[model samples]
Structures are given as C-alpha cells and as structure tokens.
Target: MPHSFALQRSSVHSTAFRRLAWGLLVASWACALVSIGLSLARWAAIGHAMDWGRWLPVTVVPAQAMVAGVVAPATMDTAWRWLGVALECIPGLALLYTVLCVHRICRAFLRGEVFGPEVVRGFRGVGWGFLAMFVASLVYQVGVSALLSWLASGQKAGMVVLGVSSFEMSVVVVGLMMLLLAHVLAEGSRLKAESDAFV
Candidate 1:
C-alpha cells in the first residue's frame, strides 16, 4: 500500500511539473515573438532613414585618439546597426527551439515513456541546440564587431573584441552535459529493453 501511494504521489508531481513547464514555455514563446517583431520594426525604420536610401539609423560621436598621431572620425555608419542588435538576439531564438525540445521531453515523461528512444532523441536535440546557440552568439559578437570596425576604418578607430564570455562558456558546458545525459539515457533504454525481454 505504501509503495502504491508513493507511486501515485510521484505521478501527481510529474503531471504538475509538466503542466507548469507547458505554461512557462507558452509565456516565454509569446514574449520572444513580440521581441523579435519589435526588433524587425526598429530595423525597418532605421533602414528607411539611411542617407543612401538604404534605410539605416545614423549616429554621430566625437572623434577620439588612442595615441597622439592616430585621430578618429566623429561620425560613422550607424544605420544598419540594427543588424547587430538583431544578430545579438539570435541566441534567444535558439533557446526557444531548445524549449520546444524540452517540451517534447516533458510530454514523454508525463506519458511515463521516460526511457523511450524519443526521449533520448529529444535530449540530443536540446544538447545540439544549446551548442548551436553558443556558436551563433560567438559569431554574432565577433562578426558584428568586425563589420562595424570595418565600416569605421576610414575615420573612427576600428575595434574588435574577440573572446568567449563566461556565460557562453557555461552554455557550452551545459550542452556537453546534456549530450552526456543523452548517452546515459541511451544506456538506460537499452538495459530497460533487455529486462523487458526477460519478463
């Protein structure tokens, strides 16, 4: 009777957790969509205002000199700066995809199919998604920095900062961990099949 009660309790907990995860995912996905829409609108506005009729925002900054001989320009192409802003947001989109994978995993768990191949595959998807996000973020930062610097090459001092952030490194580590978990799940699923065959 105690074991039966414990099993029921655990089932209830899993169900509750699944429901909560679904709600949170829906809310987060809505927010992400809104954010992406707003970003696109802002970029469109900037692009329309460009001097070349290319539609981009413009900003003017005072000239600076890192050394006495090297002078910088007071103005640069700040128009397509919206592109950089948009690029920076790529990770958020990747995370949304990851959330979808997690949602699938949660569904499988709710159905008590936790050790199934589908669950393992979903875990693998999540791991790869995180890894992709990390790579995309790094590319965005470095690429944007380089592009901006090149645009300002004639006047403003070109600056490029290339380094992996701690947060990015952490995400990479998390991705690796997820992949490890997927491997464990694969083994578990294999063992489960073997045991079931005996039964």
Candidate 2:
C-alpha cells in the first residue's frame, strides 16, 4: 500500500516533474562528460593506434578488389584522423542537444509552466535533434568510408556505399513522432488559451 501510494503521488505534476528535472540534468551532464572523455581518449590514441580501422566503418572495394601495392594497414593520420574523430563524436553531440532540449522542458515543468511555449519549443528542438542524429550517422558512415578508401588507394572512388539500417530508420520514425507530439502540444496550447480567454 505504501508503494502504491508513492506511485499515486507521481501523478502530481510538481512532484514528478521536479524529480524528472533534476534526474535528467544530472544524468545528461554525466553522460556528456563520459562521451567527451572517451572522445579525447580516442583522439589521443590515434598516434600509437593499431587496428584503428576496426573502429571505423569498413570501405569496400568493387568486388572486393585489391590493387597491388595498395596500403593495407588501414590508417588515418593528419587532418584525416581529426575528421574521423569529429565524425565519431557527432552522434554524441546530437544526443547532448536532445538532452539539452529535454532539460529545458523539464525546467519549465519544474517551474509549473506546464504546456508553456518553452516546453513546446523544446519538444520541437528534440525532434530536430533526433533528425540531426540520423543525418549525422549517415555523414559519419560516408565520411569514414571515403577517408579510409582514399588512404588505401588514391585512384579508387569506391566509397559510394549507401544503406539504411534499422537504427537509422528507427530514429527517423522517432523524430517524426516527436514532431507530431510537438504539434499536438501546440494545438493543446491553443485550446488552453482559448478557454482561458473565454473564462
């Protein structure tokens, strides 16, 4: 009965939303810090890195053909390594953006600004962030493939690989769903304003 009572208390806006606000703020910052630390570690490892190509998306040649004297070690150096690291970090950055938007919405709820313009905008921002994640993933795959390919064989332009996986398609669906939610919130806000004016 006590557990059920706590569950029931969660239905109250102020209690639940304040909890969510603080929880998300803490978790988001923690994950963002971890991600940055990992990225820095990877960047620093670029110098003495073997099997680094295993961390990257593989660049396939047509028919898996290998020209004689082609570079086989699969290495990235100089500006290429920086680009690779930046590409790897982009998805994390996108996720951070989404969390930031969620944090904003949570803050609004904590302040009793439920269904306010800030929350609506935050939802839209998160929707765009999800879409940005999908886009960034595509760019990462393509860019890494191209970089690896060019480093392998200068004459080969065989990096035209393109395919959509379940995760990519799933994020698109989620992004659209978030956008729909934002639209619904906008409509609800309109109705609320109308009712308030009527009152």
Reference-based TM-score, model 2? 0.71
Residue clash pairs of candidate 1: 46-55, 46-56, 47-55, 47-56, 48-55, 57-79, 73-155
Residues 1-199 of candidate 1 have per-residue lDDT tens digits of 5697578558756757668756765775677677566644543443232355557545322111121122223343465565546664776678778877877887776666768899898889889988988887776556555545555575345565456767789989989999999999999999879977976
- The reply for model 2, stretches above 4 Å from the true place, is 1-12, 47-76, 89-93, 152-160
| Tens digits of per-residue lDDT for model 2, 89-190 | 777789889888988887787776666689899989989999998997777666655655666665365353345778899999999998999999999888
Q: Least accurate stretch of 10 residues (summed lDDT) in model 1?
A: 60-69
Query: In order, what is each prediction's RMSD in angstroms?
Result: 7.5, 7.1
Q: What global local distance difference test value does model 1 have?
A: 0.65
Computed on alpha carbons, the lDDT of every model, listed in order, comes to 0.65, 0.69
RMSD of 1: 7.5
**Shift in Å, residue 176, candidate 2:** 0.7
TM-score of each: 0.64, 0.71
Please report, as a residue range, the 10-residue window in candidate 2 with the lowest summed lDDT: 61-70
Model 1: how far residue 45 lies from native, Å = 6.2
